[model samples]
Target: MELEFAQQFVRPILDKISSTPSSSELIIQDFAVIMIVASIMALISYKLKQPMIMAFIIAGMIIGPNTPPFSLITHVEILHVFAEIGIILLLFVIGMEFPIEKLKNVGKKATFIAVAEASGTFMAGFAVTQAMGFTFFDSLFVSLAISVTSTVIIMKVLEELGMIKDEATYLIVGIAVIEDIIIISLLAVLQSVASTGDLTINEVGMSIILVIAFIVGVIVLGSKIVPRCVDLVGKTNHSELLIIAVLGVAFGLSFIAFKLDISVATGAFFAGVLVAESKMRIATKIIATPIRDMFGALFFISVGALMDIKQLPLFIIPAVILIIVSFSAKFITVWAASRAQRLGKTTSLKTGIGLSSSGGELALVAAKGGADVGATSSFVLPMVGAMTIISTFISPYLIKYGWKLASRLESKGTGSSDTK
Candidate 1:
């Protein structure tokens, strides 16, 4: 029903772009449309106190080929390239912020929590999707998508609520870092599996070995080399040159990863890690942030653009079910893990709520990977996009109310102890 409406609505717009003589003009017009629409949506999102990333996505859905009315984007292929760059930069910045020292300091408790929560959520997601009658590969992709929380969203909400300095914040961030690492590694392995189109133990084992080797080789060698090169660039006192040099390394490593059939996200992340070891980490991050933001928006916009709104009604029920199951599983696993670490009940509850949001860049990346491989169901990407937007929308409220709930529970416990 929606498809018929979209087809009729999109025909004239497609014809107009097709008739346009100059390719460059079409590109310019597309950029203008994207920026103007995205800015407007972002402003509305701001007014509504929603995540800006969600705004960018909604903007894409509005202007993209999948929706009704003005389907403004003509050159989706170009946008896709930009989106890939966005993912690279997004992961790179995340990697830069996570230095080896910080990971080492994340502690056993945080490590345990991260692993436990990720494993539990992944299992739960798989089971739920399988029960929903999804294929094995679709279930695998969906499970992977929901296993990790959005570190960016969590931190942003924490800062907004003035809880960035809270004790639980540390553990939450630590667990997020570990989850990022694990997810990226899984992406690399998944890429390998996709490339070979074989699920045999030999192939799987080889893929894991290759991923480990690539990571160890880059870290062990790049740490010694990237820092000294960065220091030298810093001494030049040329910001432009510093930026170019860092991007060169990022793209350079990413290219190598691509050639090796690994996910470029893995390479870009480790590249940032290597750069972080340098004295110029702060300067590089400052230089790289705007670039990351721009490309990151493009990446998310592309994700939204790929969403088939016409098919959304078909997947809406599954998306809602997955959201509820995934969020509950994550919250329970995180809370239990925190409690096991001897974190107080209030802190544990806060940590659990803080990490409960199930969608982010990584989830979208995983969905995209599944789509690219053609190994998952057609509904996976759009379904994940829907889930992401909904979860991001509700996460802040959950955190805010979760604080009051935790406080009440603590009061009840105190009263019971007093009575005792």
Candidate 2:
């Protein structure tokens, strides 16, 4: 009786925290575990010519919340903050890399391509969801979930391959980015509409107007005005001041966007792009580099640490279904778009595979939509994390095989010409 009483009294309390460590000490342990594992795996992935994102994801799966011998770093809020910082710097870096005039060169073809991919993926994901016996809304959510290609990893691969200046590459980037803009804009409206289950055309119109106004307003005002402000801050010429200056710009824009109910990342990206057009662009990167890396590491670490292996069983089918549909959707749309643009077969095939991968940010946006509609919970968010790793791992291999097919086509044409 005494043993039973003690077990009943103390076990629940211990189990709550032990079951899922909310204790600060446990969190610190989580951080240490994440950093060490992430670093080691990153080195391995780098040596293997793969994306570090893949390394991070695999590490996360190994050490996630539901897994046995849970990762040591689970309890730390520090990693969370670091991950957030990583995202900020990442969005800014994306903006910095996109040259404004260069975007003009991709205009019409890029728009058509983006629309085609977004539409195709939506259909495919939705159909698979229905065939798999999920509700229409569920199917829609999951389809949109995996539909878009990841911009960050794709850009890196393209740059490493020395194809950023290639017209086909630009087409992919432009279309993806624009589709991202539309998806996010819809997400903002969806959050409101989902909660109320009420639609007034006037109210919907106003929301659409606000979103458009915000994007246009940022480009016009932010591009011209924000850079000047950063320049003033940078003129101080103190290393510390420059660091503070860049942080201030990122945070200030992010905060403003938040207050206006826009994505902080979109704000950060626009701010960075504007800053890039200015003299202080180099200084901004120099100031932000070390910070970005530290946070970037933490971001991946948190990603690895946050995986809930417990949820894997539930997600197993949906996750696999989501990825397969997403691949088909992106491939057909991009190939058709390439053909429309009169691209050679080589460029068209290359563009299709180059874009088969998905982006983290798009999933972030759609998952938020799922939460807003009560269609998903915190659990669904990490599935996006899983899909990201899987797609990234396979994309490079696909590209490698694609190149060989292209080479064969070219060789056959050469042989035929000689016979003629």
Candidate 3:
């Protein structure tokens, strides 16, 4: 029935439009519609106390090609350009938040926990999927998708809870930074493997070397170059020129990374970090936030737009299974890692729940890479999206109640000790 409907109405229109390119006015109209819908959804999300990112995804679903009544977007390619810009800006802002000196203060314990939890999460994901009879490649994608926590969402929620000053929060943030570096490198390797269908040990080794070299080069060169450039620009005291210079550095490094066949996120992020060293970082972030938010909205919406509701049901069971397994695995792994670091039981629980709360932006980022390389199924985004939504809802509550639960236990233990 749907096929017939598409044949009668959708196909003919698509054919006509494909032959005759859409006018600039039509493209503008399409984008205007997207923004209008997104704005409405954003308001609803605000009222509902949900993440604006979730609202953007919902907006995409309503207008995306995969949903019913055909796609509202005639120019997906153009929208993609906006989405890519959003990603670049998002990473750049993330980088600006972490200066190299700040990273140096992340103790060895945090580093150990980060590695332990990440590796454990990956193994749990891979093992469970394989046990369920998924293909090796499918399992790999699923594992990668589930292994990392969402640093952006977690920090926002922690800030809201006023718990950002806690030791657990610092550990979580430190772990996330490590995860970002590893995951970005992994994405590069996975993309290579996906394209060629084979990756030798030498190739993998070389890729790791290149990744390390790139990061080191960025740190060394960026540290020296960015500060001087910012100082020169700052002498003018011109806000517009400063903004241009900041964005120029951001996009310039991103462009260089792309030309060198690395993840643009890595470049943009390191660029931000380098810029972070300047006395002008706070101002740069202030100027960049509005632009970042706008583009960031479009990027997440693009993720939602790609989701095919019709295809979702087919993958629903697998998605649910993955959600359960991934969530439990992350919680357990993080809890154990925290304990090994000599944190209290309650703190461990909180860390586990905090880390488990949302797959974070990294899940979707990984899903996008999986899809690009054909390393995973088309349902990867929807799967990660569903898990992200569930985790987002549960995370804050866990942070709140988990703390209460932990405190109660601690008090109880103290009372018993006194009685003894």
Global lDDT of each model?
0.88, 0.69, 0.79
TM-scores, all candidates, are 0.92, 0.80, 0.89
| Candidate 3, residue 308: lDDT | 80
lDDT by residue (118-167, candidate 2, tens digit) is: 87887887788788777645555666767767777777766766667865
Clash count list over all predictions: 0, 11, 1
* Best-to-worst lDDT order: 1, 3, 2
**Predicted structure with the largest TM-score when compared to the true one:** 1
lDDT of 1 by residue, 1-420 (tens): 888977898877888768845889889889999988988998999998889889988888988887886578899888789888998899899899998899789999989999999889999999998898999888888999988798888888779878799878888999999999998898888878977889999999999999999999999999999999999999999999999999999999999998888899999999999999999999999989999998899888988888889998899999999999988999999989988887777788878988888898899988887777677877899899999999888887887788667667768784121221
- Model 3, residue 401: what's the lDDT? 76
- Tens digits of per-residue lDDT for model 3, 1-420: 999999999999999868855588678978998999999999999999988878998898888988898988877777678877887898888888888998788778778777887778888889988887777767776788888787777888779878888767877888887777677767666665565566688776776677678889989988998978887897888989998998999899888877765667777888898989988898889999999999988888888888887887777787778777777887888888877777777667767877875466667777776776677767677777777666667666766777667657768884121221
